[model samples]
Target: MSAFDGVKVAVLLFVAAIAQVSIFGQLHVFGAVPDILLVTLVAISLLRGSVAGAVGGFFAGLIVDTASLGTLGLTSLVLTLSGFWIGRYGETTGRDRAHAPYLSIAVVTVLYELGLLVVHFVLGESAPAGAVVRSLLPAVVLNLIVTGPVYGLVRRLLRAMERQELSAEVQLLG
Candidate 1:
């Protein structure tokens, strides 16, 4: 990706992180809050590729951790994995599928929540299985509901950026 693209991705993730913490964090629907950052990260990772996704995930997670004053590296690790694997899925089977974004978000939401449970358990924190189980499906549905619009927006932005990059390259060559 070009430097400008990277900047755009970074800014996008930054805004997503802020919204995840400040807005969506409190918006609970059936006791399941939508993870805007995760959905956004997955969208970007799908468009950009694995390395970019991993980097974006890490950066966004770090910002979230710092902003929320949570345990350092907790979200970073989870989102890094989320982004990387989602990117791989995009690069492989799902890239061209019309349902890829919704599928990715649903699957990742389940896995991400499970991963958080494992991390919390390993860290000697109470990994409330009941809570996780109860919220998991609802969260997946909520994420899927938003995935369409969020992914569409990100895809449009990336396509526009890609077109600009290609036009610039053509100009330089001409």
Candidate 2:
């Protein structure tokens, strides 16, 4: 990625982190808040690559942790994993798939929640697995619902980078 591309992604993640904490944090639909940051991170990972995803995840997660005043590094770990795996998925099989965004959102939403629960349990924190599971469906639905718009916007924003990456990959294959 170019320096400009990196800057663009940083700005995007920063805006997403802010929106997530300030706006979506307060909006509860069906007893579940939509994870705009996660969805945005997924979009970035799918568009960029594993390294970009992991880095963006860590940066965004740190911003979120600071903004929400939650346990530092907790979100960073989870998001970094999510971003790397999803970016790998994109690099291998998901980039050309139309359902990639929706599928990624659904699957990651489930895993993200469970991962958080597991981490909390490990940390001896209150890990309400039952409540998290109960709310899982709604959160997944909410995330999937927003996937279309978010992915589209992200793709559009990163169109130039996508073209560059594709050409580079094609040359490598050739």
Candidate 3:
């Protein structure tokens, strides 16, 4: 990707990170909050590629970690994995599929939460199994709800920007 594309990804992730921490993180519904950052990362990764997705995930996780003042690399690790695999999925199978975004969001939501629990357990933190189980369904549903609009917007933004760049390149070459 172009440097401009990287910058755009960064800005987009930055906005999503801020919104996730400041807004979505606080807006708990049915014992779960919508993970705007995760959904955004998934959308971008799907549009871009695995490398971009992994990089975006790492930085976005860092932003969340620093913003929330929680464990530093925790979110990064999860997001990195989510971003990489999701991007690979996009690259391989899901990119053209109509239900890719929804399926990706749902599957990743579950894996992300489970990964969180595992990490917490490994870290000797109070990993509440009951709470995780109880909130799993709601979180999945909330994430699915978020995945649609966010994915559409991200897809539109990337395509428009890329199209503009392509046309500019063509003009210059002509």
* Model 1 RMSD vs true structure: 1.9
Residues 32-70 of candidate 3: C-alpha lDDT, one tens digit per residue: 899999999999989898999999999999999999999
Q: Candidate 2: which pairs clash?
A: none
Best of the two (1, 3) by TM-score? 1
Compute the lDDT for candidate 2: 0.94
Model 1: colliding residue pairs: none
User: For model 3, which pairs clash?
Assistant: none
- Give the candidate number with the greatest TM-score: 1
Off by over 4 Å in 2: 164-174
lDDT of 1 by residue, 5-43 (tens): 899899999999999999999999998999999999999
Clashes of each: 0, 0, 0
Query: What would the per-residue lDDT of candidate 2 be over residues 1-174, giving only the tens digit for each residue?
Result: 888899989999999999999999899987789999999999999989899999999999999999999999999999999999999999999998998899999999999999999999999999988899999999999999888898889889999876887899999999
The CA lDDT of each predicted structure is: 0.93, 0.94, 0.94
TM-score of 3: 0.93
Determine which window of 10 residues in candidate 2 has minimal summed lDDT.
157-166
Single out the weakest 10-residue window by summed lDDT for candidate 1: 157-166
